[model samples]
Target: MELNQRKGKVMIEQTLEDALSEVYLQISPNILESFPKFRPPVDLYIYDQAVAQVKKFHRAEARLGTEKQAVVATFARENLLFLLRDDYRVYAEHLSRKLGLVLVEDDFKAREVSEIFFIAFRDRMDVFLSQPKIEPFKELLRDVSILAEYLWTDPCRVEFLTKTLHKEYDLSVHSVNTMFIGLGLFVMASGARPERMEVVNLALGLILHDLGMTNVPKFITDKTQYLVWRDRGSIENHINAGLKKLERLEINDPTVRQCMSQHHERLDGSGYPEGLRADSMSMAGRLCAVADSFSAIIGDRPYHSSKVFNEAAGTLIADKGRYEPALTRLLVGLLKEGFPGCVGEDMN
Candidate 1:
């Protein structure tokens, strides 16, 4: 079973001695005795099989291992030794070409935003949340301004949005979608060109809207059943905690502060942290409240399954006076147009 490098070519067969020498040289001594009948110049197919058999007992330890180690463990362990010779190189090259193709395809899809931007945003969020002082929050505001510039000028491509929605896990995904929804609403409502500072503030509020949840214990956050009264109270306080943290950070913009503080406030005075009614709510605060609530209804939550798009929309509409009716209608319309409902199966 000679393995040929060129497709469809035969591989050279080898004696047991030749196979043993090659095998021993390539593998560790601890694993060598397991295969005593090893032959040299053996068919590449048989060689691959032998290597595979040995690997079955020796698992690879690292996520990224050497090519030779990968080849031996993958193809060889499966007993396809005939692929060892030229076939191995050919297969490696084929895989390389395939990876290159995939990367090119991803580049085409990712033209609107770079991976670097997302990484930077995530890192900045971590720093903003962890900083014991106020300076980092200010720095975070600057970085977020740059991020907003990218979003406002270039805008995320449809594919970029789809990919991000699919790739992100729960909390991050919710945060990103809320930012997009809030920004869209701000654009529609303001009429004026979105000022860079306003966009940055909006982005910061959207991203950190749930930051206080970090204070909530995992047991409470992850409870699949309805939270008990005490737990429920704790959960409610997360909003207050978030506002206090922002206040400590010296975030002085009333719109920004209200966006964070009143996101949970209802028009009926039923909401938390003072529960100021609609007449007293700032427009920014109202928009954030609507966006945050709508996104949450459509998104999967700890104790509840995600509501269907229409159902979630109806709930928002039912809130009516509690939320701005016109804005609610626009959001429902956006949902109807098939932007993936904020929650449920992967968007793509």
Candidate 2:
């Protein structure tokens, strides 16, 4: 029985690849009336059963509100259903709703949703980085909007994501971590409920703040040794590089532009790219600075050892006049209050 259970787990793991290829769409309001004319663009499958037997009920043969439909809805409720990857926009509303549900649900369901969403989101970022096209950029914004909504609904997701964040540094993961941390900071700082668009734009800025780093060569970014002046110059150029990419993509959102431009800028005129002082920086810029710095410190990179929650937060606190103190203190509060037992867990 143990062997069979292991085999079942393996099989499920194997099938997850195919499952991730599908997405979720909103159920049509007038399914019976819209049939034949507005059929599912791709073959539809009840995702729960598809793992064992990849059977698909064709759009042509199946009725909209039959047993299969019921099964599909059930699978969706259970987080077992998905639609074709290419047809992601076909049912984008449905996809967002399902993701929202998973985000606020139990730990197990949230983790399951995060694993799937992270892979897909990372791949989406990779595509945009590689191609640097308009469509992919827009898709990335939409994905971040969904992410922002998750935070709006449950701010504690920051602590949850912090606990689960990969200790090793990867640009994509770092960007995501920054988004969660930065957005959480924003939520905390803004006592009154912020506008929906404000959160969405801020989330986009935080996640894509490192977009310019993609332009820098891997040798410099991954260097374990001390970076020489020339290497440092190239690294600093990522801001300009990122701005250029945004220009190409025609992204004109003020918050996003400010974040990418000012994430590297410091409060005391000690940072690069612009060397803007405290009064010169925007709130968005200051928040990104703290979030980006804290994320880098906690994640294990080639040149730096990883710090636990307390150590990382302490480092930020110690750095006088560099990062915004209010923001830094809010982060510390989040680490202590948001995460139960975390204060003692990494004390050693």
Candidate 3:
């Protein structure tokens, strides 16, 4: 009877999970493993799983009042990972006692995961990395946008966003890192009062920039053989392929489409598919290009190991006609401050 009852409970949970998925358009497979990353955050596990991980978090937070805070406290208490911001590095005695959640600040480092996720993200890509296809991670982004939004404000988020971009790097990690970087650049470059929607779009665009790479066969992505120029040419088709794939979803924003399409186009007319020159590129395109290049070179990959920041910076600057000279320099500058948000302000 006990066994039957346990089975009944498991069955009920599975059914609920399925029903919740159908109701929410923004879905993620790592819902259970990740935190309640949505804005203002959510209280209950059910709401966190169904709403917090989706666009609905913004809506749900409005209707939820005091209970939401209590629930957030509960969720934070349950998940012990600390996300202390600089201001909160040392907590007051009273506040620490009152708040059950941990608030780690100042000192945290990269760690690995069995999957592409961690309770907190890290920069260490040695044996700690996971190489999954692009599709799953892209799908997971919607669920984690809230988390990504709040990462800059906390230490874990900063650590997660600063991870290296290797050849076999996890798609989700690289996308989120690029999103933060590109968004950071936009926020700084756009002005003291940049448009909020622009920040959102740039983040979304960078995260999904390489989404089409999932279409590439694993054999090719994992190809151990040295390829001739022709084989390499076919491999580079991911950018155009992504544009077409995203088009099928009927994405309404041209900015995102344009950003993705032109991310690889060189300023010197040396880039792929449609070799656009520097004069032809928009500020957004240039930002994404620099961000993508920086992210790609700083991580370890199956094809090649990660490059040091100085080495990568030198390469970008020296590679004439490949990247915007000024933007390349800014990317290098970003590394100095641990690549935090509000970089543009500092640059200015």
What's the lDDT of the predicted structure labeled candidate 2? 0.67
Candidates in descending TM-score order: 2, 1, 3
My TM-score estimates for the predictions, one after another, are 0.58, 0.68, 0.55
Separately for all candidates shown, the number of backbone clashes (residues 3 or more apart, or on different chains) is 21, 3, 6
Model 2 misplaced regions, further than 4 Å: 1-117, 154-159, 339-348
Model 3 weakest lDDT span, ten residues long: 106-115
Whole-model lDDT values for every prediction: 0.55, 0.67, 0.50
Give candidate 3 regions above 4 Å deviation: 1-168, 224-226, 338-348
Which portions of model 1 show Cα errors greater than 4 Å? Answer: 1-123, 130-139, 154-170, 308-311, 337-348
Candidate 2, residues 107-218, lDDT tens digits: the string is 2224334444565466667787777788988788777667667656655444455444557688887887787678768877886456668988887888888898987899
Residue-level lDDT of model 1, residues 1-348, one tens digit each, is 233333111232346434543433232222221222222122223333323232222222323235544554443433233323222222222222122222222211232233333444555566656663577666666656765665455342222432332123355556665665677666655544567777888877877787787678888878888789999899889888887887787777777777778888888888877879888888877888887876677677776778765687689898657888878887666556523322322232
- Measured with C-alpha atoms, the lDDT of residue 267 in candidate 3 is 87
